[model samples]
Target: MHNLYIPVIAILAAFAIIFGGQAISDSRVDDEIKSLISKQLGVDGEIELQAMKEVQKGYGVCGQYQVADQGQRFVPFYYSKVNERVTLDADAERYRRHCGS
Candidate 1:
């Protein structure tokens, strides 16, 4: 009976760890990420996600927000990881300067 209880407790602990980690990472409104988005985009609010063909489409990592500059919008946009190393190319150098990364 004592041995059976040990296995039951171990299983419960494993489940708790798995689900707890998943819940934390899946949260949609992380303060740190939001602050970064706000700082980079120079705008803040709900991210626009118009489904109509003629409407503006918001894009971001994890599909959460728009990151384009006010006057520099473009289709097929791109975003680099905040921690990614800056490449030596002119475009990448410009990006690093623009984002202060």
Candidate 2:
């Protein structure tokens, strides 16, 4: 029926908006993570972002980075959206001590 179709369309539209918003949020956070890492390591290129997940304040990002032929290194970082800061480590001692990991 026409009324049934309306509800279906509304549900689909809601889903689209929710998913689209989340994707845009993730992309922005990922870009921020890359910039923070670049600044911290003093390198602009060779950053390979592998994974990212939402955390309490911001996100937990993991990636591989190569610095001036030093070979690729696996790194994890925590970016705090609330404080607008980044730290090295997301689930380790150092991060726990500093940012509750």
Candidate 3:
């Protein structure tokens, strides 16, 4: 089964590069994204971020945002590291286009 280990290792490595990179990138920008969301929404408390991945100029983030005690709203937002900005949009596809390549 030594041969079997090679494929398994390759698969595991691929997963690590794909997921691990995103995880690190997410943590680096999560706080800034949260702050921006809070400011834009004028909500207090925690802003939980879900899937965040590095895109072209920055990162594409989608998460549930709590507005006071009202409820949680699904928000699709983007953060451009180059521009140092956060954009909140209802449609992710549109946002992606606007965000550029």
> lDDT of each model, Cα atoms only?
0.41, 0.65, 0.68
Alpha-carbon error at 11 in model 1, in Å? 1.1
Per candidate, the number of residue pairs that clash is 0, 0, 0
Task: Report the Cα RMSD per candidate.
Answer: 10.3, 3.8, 5.7
Candidate 1 matches the true fold with a TM-score of 0.40
- Over the stretch 31-94, how does candidate 2's per-residue lDDT look in tens digits? 7867777888787675656645555534343333334345666666666676556776556664
Off by over 4 Å in 1: 43-60, 66-101
- Judging by TM-score against the true structure, name the best candidate: 2
Residue range 1-101, candidate 1, lDDT tens digits: 88999999999999999999966853432444445555555576533321111111322223223443443332121233345222223245443443333
Model 2 per-residue lDDT at 56: 50
Model 3 C-alpha lDDT versus the unseen true structure: 0.68
TM-score of each: 0.40, 0.71, 0.55
Q: Looking at model 1, which ten-residue stretch has the lowest summed lDDT?
A: 50-59
Error of 1 at 20 (Å): 0.9
Give per-residue CA lDDT, model 3, range 6-93, as digits (tens). 9999999999999999889667778788888888878777777765656664434433444445556666677666655677774656
